[model samples]
Target: MTLQYIQDKEGKTTGVIIPIKEWQSLKEKYSELQEEVEPSTELMSWQKKILDERISDYFDDPENVGDFERTLDDIEKSL
Candidate 1:
């Protein structure tokens, strides 16, 4: 597998990077480690619909811009 180096924002090399193929394989294995998880097309579609509705609602409500930003921050923190 191919590999490369990761860099910092200041253009300094930080560490080695795994190749994309290996990274994907690692991800699959990692997910498998969490055996409780299952594939869910229906949940994914529902989430997509909810996301689309929220985005459209954001555009409709100017006052919600700040709420949207805070929501994003909360989601990021949760991640």
Candidate 2:
């Protein structure tokens, strides 16, 4: 693989340029090299139970839930 350096007006190296094919190949290989992790069965069971309870509680008092879309819009505006 050959790398070409991009220079600024003063000839100072600021970035690099590589062939598109080489870049795509590198990206593909790096993606394949990522580690895969399996969630623990015990922890997943506990999380599922908690989520189910929350859903049940929400249904028990549907009027108590705030406007989800408005809440999300407010959050995005704040960010």
Which candidate leads the pack in lDDT?
2
User: Model 2, range 14-45, lDDT digits (tens) per residue?
Assistant: 99998988977876787753333334456577
- What are the runs in model 2 whose C-alpha is more than 4 Å off? 1-43
Candidate 1 segments whose C-alpha is farther than 4 A from its true place: 1-43, 66-79
Clashing pairs in 1: none
Worst 10 residues of 2 by lDDT: 32-41
TM-scores of all models? 0.29, 0.39
Q: Write the per-residue lDDT of candidate 1 for residues 12-79, one digit (tens) a residue.
A: 99999887779778778798644544555565778899999999998898585666688999999999
* lDDT (Cα, 0-100) at 75 in candidate 2: 100
Task: Predict model 2's lDDT versus the native.
Answer: 0.82
RMSD in order of candidates = 11.8, 7.8
- State, as a TM-score between 0 and 1, how close model 2 is to the true structure: 0.39
TM-score of 1: 0.29
